[model samples]
Target: MKIGRNEKCWCNSGKKFKHCHYGRESEQAITKGELIGQSKNIRSRKCCYVPKALQHECDRRIVNAHTVSKSGSLIEIADSTNHVYGLKINLANIFKNKGKLVPEKIGVNQASTFKGFCSKHDKQLFSCIEDHPFNATEEQCLALMFRSVAKELYAKEGSLLSSEVIKSGDKGKQLADQLSIQKFAADNQLGIKAALRELSDFKDQLDGQLLGNFTNNLSHLIFESSRSMPVAVSSIVSPVSDFNGTIIQDLGDLNVVAEQIVFNSFSSDGKGYVVFSWLTKSAIILGFVNTLIAIDKAGIFGALIRLFFGLAENSFISPEWWDGLPDAQKKKIESLIMSGVNPFKFDPKGLLIDDGVNFSGWNIDNIRKINF
Candidate 1:
């Protein structure tokens, strides 16, 4: 006869099956047998995104929702408007090829959807939040997109690690890196949360403020983009030699490096922001005071980095901005790209700077900044 989890042990030990023989049997079944239990409590799987205020009365009909909409192709360009662009990237390849100078091949696009909200909330509340990429004109949209990608990536990475532990019963080097990435992703989530809180708390005071603007006026950059790229791009770093053949495993490293190059346009005293898309391996950095100095700091990698920036700038800003730059600055950037020295070996101290960006327009110069 089959024994229930709460039933007494078949060995007549007067203990619950889960506490005795069944426990050992279950362990053995998981380790030695091919079949594993797939059952889960439906109620336990209910969505967590529902606000507590509305959750109590709502009939939670939970569904797996895509953090980034999956409707469009991974990369697309419209003939009608050359300015609009859409893109997505494979996150798995980025992790698998961590220290490599270049990815062996692009990874298959991974799903960003997860069970997070009920059908009602998913459509009414969550949908609006996820729509930031399309609707937002300022940097807040990037922050929202980053948070969404980071949250989903963290969940997926953890699930993969758990599956590996069950299948191979080993925690290897990959696991260590995965764990580190997971932790940083979690921290990124926290940073996003703090940013949101700051925004919400000071919304009344900072109306009509631009926290930051798009890199190339590519307001339509994410119009048709897949949801998978933000996390993928955020996790990748160039100059493969920087981390001793390992991509950045810490969020702090990512923030510092990105600020040094991509966000160089933002003021040194102001907040820094970065949004990367997988489609073209392009990034948009915001809130920098001077764009030229930032490009200079990229050194030998300036060419590749500038290429992506050029793509973004071309898409958004008018050609006048490019033409407006001093010829001397243009030559300097071109020279750095030609030099071809590994950026890591150059001025390492130049890369280190502020750790986080303020997405909220609230001036907290007098207040202690919140750390992610």
Candidate 2:
């Protein structure tokens, strides 16, 4: 039987489900004792209590988003529109406690964000915040801020999004919501029509090329083909072995794919975001190379690094706001991509950034398989 993500792991490390005890469930949860000196906005109480051990199946537990501190405090996201919230965390604190963040690849799953994430000058949320309730962890603060700003942006349109719409339940879904497609381009300012064409074109092949023969004969491979480009555009899969919609296993790499997906989906103004992503990639590579050079650490990856940056500078990077990257970092990035070694096989050591994990072993893109 296939193992569900939420099921107890067969490895049995006394950790239940994923990394133990629905650990991933309440992503907003901070380690209990670690909250000792949290934020001044958070009050500590003698009544503080740790939760009891889990008894029932992890899936049976319900998530309570409105959790409060024993000191009678609740996290609040003041509606702020003038400011667009990016990752808001005290990185210095994290560096102090966790040591340096190990400088690695970082990518949000299905990592799409609004192309131009700026607020009207009058609506800036980045300004004015006396007391941050969360401490040390910028991610939590940033997430909270992103949600708050997003809500403010949505409110302007008079749309009342349900709380359920904000669940971190699926990164892909979250990325879709953030793009605000339906509203971002109600009249098509971001170019949604062209993006949808790819999907539509693929769908058309089934009807026009296959005729009715595909109605039952070839419906199964649609999702797989859409993501992986299929072995050949014309080939179809057996009906019994298809129809799964999951995509993207190596989330760090998703920084590219997700950005491409959303940028492609924009009805208008997308060219700007597309350009921005390439710039971002270029900047990362160049910056890394510069850091290495400063420390005299450049080794064999130099060529690959330069190639990655070069692609950003010379390749088809659409919009150019992202060109704001420093010149040195951009160069190294071009080198990485244009290097002789294949990116799929080079497997840069310690290549992680953010929570991205290695996907080198994935036989397919999503599910790990079994050879019985």
Q: Which number leads on lDDT?
A: 1
State every prediction's TM-score relative to the real structure.
0.33, 0.16
Best by TM-score: 1
The total of clashing pairs for model 2 equals 43
Lowest summed lDDT window (length 10), candidate 1 = 260-269
What is the TM-score (0 to 1) of candidate 1? 0.33
Please provide, for model 2 over 10-120, each residue's C-alpha lDDT reduced to its tens digit, 9 standing for 90 to 100.
Answer: 334344455532333335444323332342112111111111121121232221111111011111111122111112122234445452211121121101122112222
The alpha-carbon lDDT assigned to residue 245 of candidate 2 equals 15
Report the lDDT tens digits of candidate 1 across residue range 1-372: 578989996544487967754435224233322212211222124454443455675555766664434332112111222222212222333234442222122112223345666677566644443343333333434333333433343344444434333333222324344345445545545444443443332221122122232133222112111211111112222222221122322333434322111111111112222232221212322222123223332231232233322222111111222234566644543332333334345432222222121111112121111110
Error of 2 at 230 (Å): 28
